[model samples]
Target chain A: MPASAPWSAAVGQGGGVLRSVDIGALELEAGGELPTVTLAFECWGVLNAAGTNAVLIQHALTGSTHVSRGDSEEDGWWEGLVGPGEVIDTDKYFVVAANMLGGCYGTTGPSSIAADGAPYGSRFPLVTIRDSVVAEARLADRLGITSWHAVIGGSMGGARALEWAVTFPERVRRCAVVASCAASTAEQIAFSQAQVLAIRQDPHFAGGDYYDGAAPTSGLGLARRIAHITYRSETEMEQRFGRAAQDGENPLHLGRLRPVVGGSFAGRYQVESYLDHQARKLVSRFDANSYIVITEALMSHDVTRGRGTLTQALTRTEGVQFLVAAVSSDRLYFPSQSQELAAALPGDVKVHNIDSAIGHDGFLTEVGTVGDLLRESFFAQ
Target chain B: MPASAPWSAAVGQGGGVLRSVDIGALELEAGGELPTVTLAFECWGVLNAAGTNAVLIQHALTGSTHVSRGDSEEDGWWEGLVGPGEVIDTDKYFVVAANMLGGCYGTTGPSSIAADGAPYGSRFPLVTIRDSVVAEARLADRLGITSWHAVIGGSMGGARALEWAVTFPERVRRCAVVASCAASTAEQIAFSQAQVLAIRQDPHFAGGDYYDGAAPTSGLGLARRIAHITYRSETEMEQRFGRAAQDGENPLHLGRLRPVVGGSFAGRYQVESYLDHQARKLVSRFDANSYIVITEALMSHDVTRGRGTLTQALTRTEGVQFLVAAVSSDRLYFPSQSQELAAALPGDVKVHNIDSAIGHDGFLTEVGTVGDLLRESFFAQ
Candidate 1:
């Protein structure tokens, strides 16, 4: 059995009761060995006698393990779907949401001290999505979860859930991959590359070992700005900010201001301010090193790396049921990709659509819709 | 009359016979005064005795006045459309393409030296798309041309063409706006803000005055990468680089490499390399400060600003013939925006669609289709 401990999130109070365990060393898919491996998770309710009532929920990129507020004061990211009498109903099923490996939320990651007593920093080995899933399986074993009643996730989390169904088919009885695909598309990798470069290009990054110095907050902020644009839809941005200037500033009237020594770049548009706010929020809480590591892991998300073709890899889950869904307006992971994933699965699986103008983030924002679908489909089984 | 001179392009020999004239200082739209303004232009063929056979072709952002090769040995950006026997037949009409006022190609911009013998840098006053059109009008006055046979452009160039039809409707007999909108949308502004921030955040940028030092190449590169992604379709990216590692390097296998001082961020995917190559090419031939100036001008693109609603703004062009077109797969400038522009126009305007899988770039890549449409519509008229 693994030893358990308590920890809080980088920002808000971590929802529910947080627990963690050192899952021992991990052999990474990219060749290096992670000397130490720890998984931080949050659970609600109790496991049934048979332990088949356990449901594993994976969090998206930059997300925490908090699914719904339990004993903690913080409101969960998915507050509408995982509580008592809710879709994933913690009242009956044991809900487990673990912060993926390489995550910073109470998890052992790049920010964690290595065996050499120094932060992994630039020395942290690249961890793939498959490697993260393998580490999570060890955590599942330690938790006495021989098999899960359901595995559910969206976005990066959905990639994890799909990996769970393929890597350890017997462990996941049912899977719901929402607003995600079986593999990271080239476009996804391109975006990820830019985000990673944004963080790394910061002067203060100091080769990723800036623990004792100023963190690469600017780079982190820029990365978040790039990412926040992708998360929301163009329609939403148009309706929200339009070409309107911020309350007191005018993007068109910047010339009247006195030029400062460093070139005063004032007069931000409302949308620019919105992006700045997002960047500032992320920089305050998230670790830059952890961000790069996690982003790289996400970029390495391919279910059929060494598992032959996509169909052959998915054949392992022939008996497992799936509830695949895609956000209608998701530009990041298009609905067509979801259709492809669904067609590759056993039987005639249809991709459920979450109709929203919220883009790729609909899986998190349209909680009621997600809850309804889960309640009627995967959870119903 | 303006004085004509000779100047070679920073890239290849500028297409056609390049010429320039000092248009003098002018008042800016954003409440400022430019002390000096010069417009660089290239002319092909000859103006008819009446001077009514002159056609103005505007170039997109990062594009030069060189539309089609004539006296110069270099290939032109629109060689397919404005050749001797092409749609806009250089043999039959005087084809004129001008570098925008804030462009780097022999045009007055942030890179231009002020009266103080120092580059404008960040101290350069903001120039709008309208201001550029005003400067171009001065150029027209000096060239003894009263009206254009037709004004045509795509993307930023398209934005310029729309401005010409509205700002000086009497001067443009026919106009073609391709893959562009009358105003900069919130989404466009948001993307522009990110690109601006990317440059400003660069440590080497030095408040936009990095001419004497190492320029913010990385920042400019990041901005280009971001912009290039939006320029093409997701399908194209998938078809082109799909998860395949770059030649001799695997993005997923970076961990086995030695943990060098700067984290040896060496292993790049093929897509990343492609972006890097694009960045390098631009850095070699383009000025970073000029890029910011032109980008800001494009972001400030709004034909309706201070001119009433979109329909009211377009009223000036009631009698002018229009050939509006949109790239079918363009995400940056959606077909809906083209539809909006077409519907708001005075006549029964139909937005010609340039069908291609290349997205917004189809306006540039689908030359045959664009040519056919121009020949069938406004040019034919």
Candidate 2:
């Protein structure tokens, strides 16, 4: 048996508790050994007598395990969709959300202390989507969830949901992969690679070993700015910011003459201000090494890596009911990619369209539409 | 008359001569003055007694004045389209190409010497499309060309070409604006802003005055990488590079352990290698400050700025014939934008489409299609 340790459970007002479980050493897909993998998770409601009513919700890159506000009064990322009387109906179904490996939210990531008492830092092993799912399965085993009633996620979270179903087909009854593809496309990888380079290029980065020094906030901010552009659609930007200068600031001659670093000239365009705000927010809460780690993991996400063709890779998932969805304006993961994933599935799976001008983030923003789909398909009585 | 000086013209074998002409001190639209404005230009064929046969060609951002292999044995960018018997027919219409203001290729830009005998560097004034056209007009005066048979260009060059006709309606008899728009969209500005930030964040950038020290090659490379992604279509990137690792470079386990800067792991993806090559090439030949200057100029590309609507902006060009074209797969400047431009013109200018899978670069790559349009319309004499 794997060495297991159950840490303190911080119970919240809604009976949701945040917990961490040690799954011991894990051998990564590519190479290297993670001596001890600790997964931090949060759960709501109780398991049924048969222990088959459990549902796993995967979080996207840079997301934490706080899927909904349970103990904490702070609003969760997906608060409305997973509440007591909401679509997922937390009171009825046992819900579990885990901060993915390589994340900094109480998980055993690069920032986590190693056996030798130093932070893993640059020494952290390369982890893939499959590896994270494997770690999640260990957590599932400890919780006595033999088979999940459903698994759902969007964006990189959607990728994890699909991986769970494919890696352990018998463990998942139904899977909803929203606004994601079966694999990371070339364009997707290209964008992710650029982000990685942005952080690594920062002099303060110091080969990811800057735990005691000044954080690479500038590089992280730059990376966030780049990613934020991809998350939203062109039409949305055009409608919202449309070449308008930021209030009380002119991005013209005087602005150009000023240096950008500490000067007020950076926020010339309203769109630049929006991007700057996004970058600042992410830098404040997120870790740069975690960003790079998760980004690289997402880059290594191809469900068909060693499993032949996409059809062949998904052959094991014949028993799983699938819900594939795409945002209409998502330039990152195009709708056609979702169609390709659906077409490659074992059975006749139809791709649900979430009509949104918000681009890739629509899966997260269009909660009403997503909740409706989940209620009608996976959670209906 | 402008205080003009004809610098020595370097005549190439194909009879193309590279020359610089002083257009004197000029007032800028953005509250500054360029004490002395010199424009670098190149010419092919010969001017007739009428001088109306002179056809002005505008180059895009980072593009040089060498439109064809004239005296230079090196292959010009648009070599096949403008030789003795080609589409533009240099032999028939005295073809002249000028490197715009704020360019590095022998033109007065940020790298040029100021009145104090030092590089303009960060002190370079903000220049707009109208400003460049005004400077080009003085060059036209020196060449004794009263009217241009046609002013043609693509991408940023297209913006310059359109500005010429609108700014000096009677000087240009015909104009072709290809793969461009009347204004830079919000998304375009967002992307350009990210690139500008990337350069400024570089430790070596030193507020755009790094001429005496190591140049911001890394930051410039990052900027180029960002811009290059926007230049190509997603389908093309997928078809060409599709998750394929570079030869002998595994982007998996071992690659992840390696650091990015000066590390072999950076070129794991074939697409990354391609981008790296592109960045390297641009860094070798182009100045970082020039890139920023031209980019900002493009960002300030609203023809309807001081002018009323787009229709009002083109009101002065009622006498000039217009040819508007768009790349079918262009995502940067959408075809709809080209249609909007064509619709706002005085005449019924049909938006001709250059069907190609290459995306925004199609305007430059699909020479045959562009040449066909020019031959049929602007150069059909």
The DockQ leader among the candidates is: 2
Candidate 1 chain B, run of 10 with poorest lDDT: B2-11
Off by over 4 Å in 2: A1-17, A260-267, B1-17, B260-267
Per-candidate clash tally:
0, 6
Candidate 2: count of backbone clashes, pairs at least 3 residues apart or interchain: 6
For model 1, residues B264-379, the per-residue Cα lDDT tens digits are 35667777778777877887888877788888999889989998999999999997999999999999999999999999999899988899999999988898898999898856
Q: Candidate 2 lDDT, tens digit per residue, B163-239?
A: 99999999999999999999999999999888877787778888889899988888888899888898899999999
What does the lDDT come to for candidate 1? 0.84
Q: Write the per-residue lDDT of candidate 1 for residues A1-381, one digit (tens) a residue.
A: 321211121212323877888889999888888988889998886666566778898999999988888778888899978877778876677788998888899888888899989888888888888888999898777767778889999999999999999999998989999999988988888888888888888988877889989999988988998898888889989999888988887778855223335333567678888888998899888999889998989988999899999988899999888999999999999999999999999888999999999899999999899888889876774
Best by TM-score: 2
iRMSD (1 decimal) for each model: 2.6, 1.4
Q: What TM-score does structure 2 among the candidates reach?
A: 0.96
What candidate 1 gets wrong by more than 4 Å, as runs, is: A1-15, A256-264, B2-15, B256-264
* Candidate 1 chain A least-lDDT 10 residues: A2-11
Q: How high a TM-score does candidate 1 get?
A: 0.95
